[model samples]
Target: MFRTVQDFIEDYRDESQNTLKLLNLLTDESLKSANTPGFRSLGHLAWHLVHDDAGMLRRIGLDFKAPPAGAEPPESAAAIAAAYRETAESMLEAASRWSDEKLLESHNMFGRNWQNGLTLLMFVKHEVHHRGQLTVLMRQAGLQTAGVYGPTKEEWEKMGMTAPK
Candidate 1:
């Protein structure tokens, strides 16, 4: 969990950029890819990633510019990528104002009391979880994905090296 607002902001900056890199690889047509019928499509998940930050941050008393919940994702994947970048910037700005003391304060969240710090941590984890899902769907859609956390198989090959087992 984050003990300082700066730590949270820094982590978000890196993770959000990672997310944006993967999101930019999506095409409008690939948004239709899903693991199964009735499952959430890439479009829905991408849009969720685009807007979930503002919604979660709003719960912690930080408001940012994002589309309303349930808003349709723009038809262009580039637009979705652009919106994610902007909303991430807004979240960083809002979170930067929090103090260590304020982060330690408890609040009722989802029927349970939680420290503001925990909430911010959860926000980062949530982005990571969904971004992982997006990567899987990206592969299913035949798009080359940028690996986060480590180099992908193709990335390793591009460097004329073998990926570790």
Candidate 2:
């Protein structure tokens, strides 16, 4: 968990860039791909990441507002990337208004009080988890996967490098 607001902001900036790269690899057709019918599509997953960050901020008594209710998921990869960037910017801006003490203060989330730092960390982890899933789904749907933490499998092959040890 983050202890200082600066730590959260820096980490968020890095993670958000990675997310944007991943989104860039999506295709319009791939947005509808999912493991099964009724499961969340790639577009849905991306949209959720955008809204959920704002929701977590709200749960911590912040003024962050989620995307509009029933907003249709964007099919275009460009749109998804743009939305993620916008949300990340808003999150950082909101965080900038808080002090380190405020970040460490307790806030209620899901009926339990947690330090705001912890809640924010949880939100970041949650986004990463879903994003990892989306990357695999993207491959299965025949879309290219962009390098996030490091080079993706296909990327490594293209560079004449085997998977990292």
Candidate 3:
């Protein structure tokens, strides 16, 4: 969990950028990619990350510009990516107003009382989880996925390094 607002902001900035990188790579056709029938599509996962952040942040009195919860994913990939970018900036702005003490305070989240800091942590983790799912769908859609932590296999190959098996 974050102990200071700056710590979370710094991490959130990097993570949100990584998400944007992946989002930008998506094509309208790729958005329909999914592992199986009736499963969540790549577009749905991406939009969920965008909208759900608003709901979670609002719980801690942090409001960002985002689509309402349960909003349908847009058909245009560019629109989805643009919305994510906008919300990321908006969220950072709201979080910047918080002091470290505010982070430590308790907030009602998902039927449980949670430290605001923990909620921030969980929100990032939730995004990361769906991001992993997106990479798989991107691959299925014949797109080269970007690396969030390090280089992706395609990136490594471009760098003249053999990717791990």
Model 2, which residues run further than 4 Å from truth?
Answer: none
> How does model 1 fare in lDDT?
0.87
lDDT of each: 0.87, 0.82, 0.89
* Candidate 1 lDDT, 50-133, residue by residue in tens: 886346567778777877877888889999999999999998887877777878877777788888899889889999999999
Q: Write the per-residue lDDT of candidate 3 for residues 1-165, one digit (tens) a residue.
A: 999999999999999999999999999988887879888888888888787645777878887778888788999999999999998899999899889999988988888999999999999999998889888889888999999899999999999999998
Candidate 1 TM-score over all chains jointly? 0.95
- Per-model TM-score on C-alpha atoms: 0.95, 0.90, 0.94
TM-score of 2: 0.90
Clashes of 3: 0
lDDT of 3: 0.89
Cα lDDT, model 3, residue 152: 97
Q: Which one wins on lDDT?
A: 3
Clashes of 2: 0
- Model 2 lDDT per residue over 16-132, tens place: 888888887788888888887888988888777777644667877656445664688887878877877887888788888899998778877888888999998988899899889
Candidate order, lDDT descending? 3, 1, 2
